[model samples]
Target: MLIRILFFLAFLFLIDWYSFQAFKASFPGNFWVKLAFWSFSIIVYLFVAYTFLTFSNRGVSSPNFGRMASLLILSIIPKLIILTFLFGEDILRVSTGAFQSIAGSREGDFLPDRRKFLNQTALALAAIPFVGILHGVLIGKYRYRVIRHTLEFDDLPEEFDGFTITQISDIHSGSFDDRKKLEYGVDLINQQGSDVILFTGDLVNNRSEEMEPWIETFKKLHAPLGKYSILGNHDYGDYMSWPSQEAKAANLQHLFQIQEELGFKLLRNESVQIQKGNSSIDLIGVENWGKGFAQYGDLAKAAANLTKESFKILMSHDPSHFDEEVKSFAHHIHLTLSGHTHGMQFGIEIPGFIKWSPASLRYPKWAGLYEELGRYLHVNRGFGFLAFPGRVGIWPEITVLELRRK
Candidate 1:
């Protein structure tokens, strides 16, 4: 927990530094500009903070309010100090260079008049909050758009052609207190012309009862090949307060019962055949496989009763499963589907720079669809959030994959 909190702070610092640099680069050097930048930034921060803090304690006493106000002041003081240390220099250099280029009306660098530069820097600080809020909305509300794109596999076997798989991952139902939202997502899924649907795990977060309210809504999802599901890291009754091992076992059993209630065929180290006209392909699903998490996915176990000649599509939640476990499995899975990485909830994708979120740096195929070694893997950005409780650029996903014959 301490490590996670530290990481979050470090991430915020990086964002502030980058934004400061960009702001500095865009403005012209002037005293008024610099003063306005800094003063406006201070005011924006204080205003937002005051608004939140004021409303945060609605029925508090005057004494309580005094203490809370002191605490708020203390907190902002440290953040201001930290912000200067973290971003002060980077902002100056980037801003000066930017102002010179803008003044000259070309892409060249030169130092700005120090006094004027400082003034502009302060003004730019005002713009910072606006930019920060914008960045927050872009990353939080739209991050998934970059990673969530419609994929068409032109070489899919004819048997599975046009097989649109409406995938939802990392539902984390425990975090969702509203049934109406779940129903909306479900309704959207049902409306998509999907021939088959795959739910790549993390269905109920930690407990079976978390999904109880949405069982009827989820059951409404029906396709010709039906809805199939696999387990994700959170599905194994981990990260919870259980009375005993027996209680955990009972929870898992109840989870299976919920899957049955929701009309989803739970795939646990097993294979099923989906028939189409005269040909059929194997749909295999395995237990979650992730590094340092559950290492229970057995490729051989999933293929035990299936033929080696079968055209296979495997649903395994973690993308790491494909890169590590299934990439070289003997049966040669032609297509693998997964989700788990929500694209770090931030990033930019452009012509020369696909500055995807830092999360992708840790996991190479962290988002979107990719192919390697003659096998295809599509990683869904996910339909929900976990710790942050909101997406940035990576929004909730509704993937519709079109499979075409080779």
Candidate 2:
């Protein structure tokens, strides 16, 4: 771990050095101007190092420190972009020299100095991502988009036709910095007026205490039928080191209690029957089940009393569960809701045009809707940001799924 940290810092320094070179070439000025630029660069470097060390000493549990670290790291993105252009120019210069030498033509020098236009152009281009990332951190992270999808299912219960279900996931409460912004998101969820509200998982980052400040805000959310939730990988406190097993168990119990306080029925490998008139549908929820993460969910146990004829909606945190277990189960799960990916909190999505994110490389069903074997899975982009403390193209999401009988 220590070696990895050292390597990371060294890499960051190299990028910073190249970025400084670009700055020097692009803006050659008086001593004061040079001092100012160098000072700013040095401060950023020192701050990043200090923040990481402080967070590491604190066991890296505090979300504020994590956010600070993220912001620091993000500040370097523009510099890296600038360096890319600078390095590309250098490669072109070298190639030109090689070709000229092969032709027996003597040049003024083996390699030319950095081009001013190229450096300036790189600086200009770097501003795009720099401003974009700033905007993402300031405004995009709280931009709650309500994505609605009406899914038609032949096996759906007639009574549940047009049943509206609002789903949100990956609410990393520990990372929230603004209460008013969070309240607005909760209000938006309430505004949907769906029949049921379903939270896929990740109520908190790692501990139950993180949700204490936002409990009342979430409790305001309402649904006519009910509100249901299942644990995500983060809610289990698996990422942190607990002093004792009993303490860890207690933390989980408190999290469950917090869920109840917020009017969410915490479903741990269990199923509930929702009734309407003479008809009923099964809402089965399992614990955090992912391919590479924790696997505490029992699909069979959750569907114990239900049969193949049951019209079921399964709530599992990770979308991978659908591929790994749910779809191949004996009973047909009509719809599965998940939200562990958060669309990577960055991506491009143009309706009817394109939807792409780096997260797709890992989780094939990263966001939006997917269907296989006539079964559907809806992956919510997530309600809150994590790790990065901000979002880019993929804004926070509030998903409303309407079930229809075909």
Candidate 3:
């Protein structure tokens, strides 16, 4: 691990050195600009290394690390964009030098002179993402958008034709730095006036206590029917270190209690009935199940008594579960609610014209609604940010799903 980290840092240092050349090329005479540039660059790199080296043992739990991680991300991304232009120009310069050698011409230098205009252009282009990364860290993560999706199904219970379910997933409370912003998100969920609220999981990042400070804030969310929740991979305390097996078990049990305090019925491989008038539908929930992550969910167990005829809505934290099992399950789960992807915390999503996220490469059903084999899945983008501590075009989502009988 230490060797890998050192190699990674060395790569970053190379980029830092290369990008600084662009600064020099653009501002040849401004000594102050160069001084300030190196000063900020060195400080950021040192802080990143210091945080990793000093806090690796107690890192995830520290509030300071989250800020440091975000700062590192903001710095690295723009620098990478700058690296792209600089690297591309260098490639062209090499090709030109090779061509001059073949033609037997003596040049001032083996490679052509680096153009000031290109360097200036690179800096200008880099500023776009520099500002974007800065904004994403500051405002985009908190900029919540309510996505309304109406799903029509032939087998939907008539009583549930207009049943509205507001779903939020991946709270990652450990990453939250602002209470007011989260409270505002909670308020937005309540304002939707949905019949019931379903949180598909990831109530906290790595530990249950992370959700303690915001328990009261989230308790404010209300639904006419009730609020239902299921566990995500992070809720199991797998990402952080624990003293003993018993302590890890206790941490999970504490998370169950925390969910109860917030008026959520945490379902673990279980099913409950949501009754309306003379009709009812199965609301089944399973533990976190993914291809690479924990496979704690048992679909057969969760749908033990139910059959394919039942009008069912399932909650599984990871969308990978849908493609792997749920879509072809004998019980035929009609709709699956999930949020583990978080759209990779970055992407370009423009609805119809373009909807692309790095997460899609991993999760086929990364965000919004997807249908296959006559079964449906709605992958909530996420209610909160994760490791990156910010969102790009794929902003945090509050999914409002209205079930309709067709």
Candidate 4:
């Protein structure tokens, strides 16, 4: 742990020192700028070192850890951007130095002078994310967007056509500190007036009790039909240490009870039939089942006695499960709802122009709706932020899905 911390600090120092070169290039010989630059850099480094040195197993439940992570992101991302350009500049400098040394110039003075325009351009570009991240921490995370999507299916129950369902995932209640902002999010969900509300998972980050404070606020979410939820990996409390197996088991049970109190029919590898008129559709929910995550969910058991012809909507936390397992199941699942990947909590998403995030490299279907083999999967970006404590371009989402019979 200590070695890793030292390595991280070393990396930060390099980024800081290299970035300072640009500062000097841009403001050549400005003593005050140099002092302020190094002063801020040293303070950030010291604070980061202290944070990692004093780290504990408080896990995701600790707000301090989240705050520290946010600070690091805000500090490092812009610097990394600056480093990108600076690195290119260094390549040119080194190449010039090599050529000058071959021509008999003194080795130390071989490199050419810093290009002010190049350094200024890098600084200007880096400033974008710096201000953006600052705004993300202050306001973007609380910025809730309601996405309305209509999915059409030939087999959709006629009665259920136009049936609207609101979906939100990854609440991570432990990470919530602002009651007013949280209440506003909940109120926004209520304002959608979807027939039924479905929460894909991650109600809390590590412990069940983390939801204690926000239970009432979330309870305000009203759906005409009912509210339903399933477990996410974090809801299992597997990320944290427990005194005993019994304690962990009790914690899970307590979470279930909390969901019950909040009026969510917590589904644990089970299926429920939603009846409308004479027709009904199966809403099967499984425990956290993903390729790299916990596999407590039993799909066969959840789909027991359900026919392949029956239209089914699945609620699984991780999108990997949809790609890895749910797609090829003997019993066809028409639609799957998931939200494990939080778009890495940062990305540039433009409705039709471009939608990109670092998370796409890992999970192709990281967010939004996708179609495969006539089946549909909608991955909610998430209703809350996690470790970083702030979301950049990908704002908190409240999805309203309407089913259309074709």
Candidate 5:
């Protein structure tokens, strides 16, 4: 723990030093100006370091502390970006001086101190990410978008041909800061008028109590068919320490009860038949399952009663499950919905022109739709932010999937 703290403080100091170098280059030969800049930089660094230490000691149980700490980390991202460009300039300057000296040029004739244009350019480039992050924290986090997709299936039941499903995942209620904004998002979900609502999980960060404040707000979500849900890794209370195994068990029980109270039929490796007239489709839901995370999901058990001809729609928390197991199952799981990646809660997405997130490198099917061998997986970007306390290019998502018969 002490080593970890030292490393964190060192990292902050490095960022501060680099920021000072960049600033000094821009306003060189002004002793008072440089002193002022140094004082301001050190003050901010010390404050952030102190906050980090306090939060580390106090624990992450409080949502406010978590938000503050996340914001502080985010604050360094712009400085780091600026530092990269400034460091490159410094390297070039050093190389030029070394080459001149080797060629017998005097010290005074070597490369000049620091190019003002280069420093200005660095600051200008850094502003882009700084402003982007500010927007993410202030606006993008609550900018809920309803992304619609039409998926066709040759074997879709005639009665359920035009069925619509609205999916919202990774609620992480603990990170929410505004109730009014959350209510607006909830209203947007209801506005979709989806036949059924499917929530792939998270719900809370580490404890069931995180959801207590938002129960009534989420309860307002209505679907004519039903609302079904399954757990995400976060819902298991595995990230936090408990006094005893029994206490952890009780916390999970309370989470289950909270889901029930919110009118969500929690499915734990279970299947439910949704009927429309004479046609019916099987909806299978499994507990949280991922590559390195928990593997509580039982695909076979969930699809046990369903026949090979059953048109199945699966709700699993992580998209990794689709790649690892669901597609290879005996019965063809026609469509799988998941949302654990949250697009890494950061990335660039532009309709059809481009869609990219760092999350894709880890989980191949990080966001949107992916198809393989006639099986489909739609990974929702997520409905809430987590450790980052905000989102950048990847805004909170509300997915409306319209099922059509091919």
Candidate 6:
């Protein structure tokens, strides 16, 4: 944490220095420019100090208000500073680039053009802040917006083809500091008329108890078929310090019970055949099986009793599991669904450059639908977030997969 703080400070210093340089170049490095720069620096420092002071005492009655306030201020400061520097740099770069281009052509005198170049660069730099503000607003509103969409797959088997399976993964129930907000999300999920529901994993952030308030609310999500779930990394209490080994084990056990209470059939390396009329498909849910995480997800064990002749749909928490092991496990699995990535809570689904969340660097199949080695994998971006507590480009997802036949 200390290292992180120091790194952040260094980053701020770099941006500030660059902005100062850009301003100097733009304004001829004279007294007015220097004075203006110093004045701005002092004002920014005092503003930050005042923010910290108020942040040091967030609310009159809230016990942890100070910490909360500090966090909020800390989170906003970097963006503020970055915006300032960007504005300065943009102006400088554009002006300089234009001046250089004109000078090279020998179409005009160089000095006036150079000054124009500098001012243009400064203008370009200033545009960065405006862009940052626009991005922040868009991301802030879009990230947190609750979205519900129903998707139908034409390749699903005829029997379960129209089977409306609603999925919500990476709920990170523990992350919600507000009960009302959580309840609202839960209510939204319950509203979907899903025939069956599958919770891909990471139900809680870390602690099993963190999911207490959500269990009952989630139980309201009922289907004629059933509600099923699998484990994500956080469900194992791996990130936090527990009292003892027994406590950790107990938390996991309690989590399973919570799944049961939520009316979900917790599938840990197991398979169950769900019959619809005369036909049936195997629903396999395995433990966390991904790169650098839990290696206990046994596809072989999960599909042991199931036959390859039957169509199979799998619920595995991490998408990388499909990449690393699913294809060779058996030909039984036709579709695999996962949700640990949360698309890093940010991403852009643009053509050609579909930049996924930061999690994509770790796991390539970060979000939405993906196919590899003839096997299909659907990576749900996730229904919640982790440390940042904001969705940004990626919104909370309640996937409605309508299985269809080819």
Q: For residues 267-337, could you state the per-residue lDDT of candidate 6 as single tens digits?
A: 99999988888887789999998798877788888888876677788999988888788867756467788
Error of 3 at 305 (Å): 1.3
Tell me each candidate's RMSD, in Å, in order: 9.5, 2.1, 1.9, 1.8, 2.2, 7.0
The best candidate in terms of lDDT: 4
In the range 47-109, model 5's lDDT, one tens digit per residue, is 656655666422454555556555565567778888888789889998988899889997695
TM-score of 1: 0.70
Could you tell me the lDDT of residue 266 within candidate 1?
A: 88
Candidate 4: tens digits of C-alpha lDDT, residues 1-406? 8898789889888888989899999998899999987787777777777777777666645777777777788778888988999899889999988988998997678888889999999999999998988888899899999999998999898999899999999999988879999999999999999888999999999899999998889888888788999999999889988899999999999999999999999888999998888999999999999887789989899999798899899999999998898989999899999998989889999988999999999998999999998889999999998888888999999999999999
Cα lDDT tens digits, model 3, 290-344, are: 9999999999999998866899999999999998999889987889999999998
Determine the backbone clash count of candidate 2.
Answer: 0
TM-score quality measure for candidate 4: 0.95
Order of quality (lDDT)? 4, 3, 5, 2, 6, 1
TM-score of each: 0.70, 0.94, 0.95, 0.95, 0.94, 0.73
Q: Between the candidate structures 3 and 4, which one is better when assessed by lDDT?
A: 4
Residue 263 Cα positional deviation in candidate 2, in Å, after optimal superposition: 0.9
Model 3: per-residue Cα lDDT at residue 65: 79
Q: Can you write out model 2's per-residue Cα lDDT over 242-343, one digit (the tens) per residue?
A: 889999999999998999999999899999999887899999999989999999999899999997898999999999999998889899899999999999
Winner on TM-score (4 vs 6): 4
Tens-place lDDT digits, model 1, residues 1-406 = 4465456445544544444443454455556655754564455445434544454322221233333333333334333543453356556767878787777855544644334354345544554444543454334432333223444455456766666677778777765545666677777877776778899998866778878877777788888778899998888877766779999999999999998888889899998988888888889998989876777788788899987777788998889988887888887788898998877654554636665777778789887778888788988878766544445445678787767665
lDDT for 214 in candidate 5 is 96
lDDT of 4 at 8: 85
The TM-score obtained by model 6 is 0.73
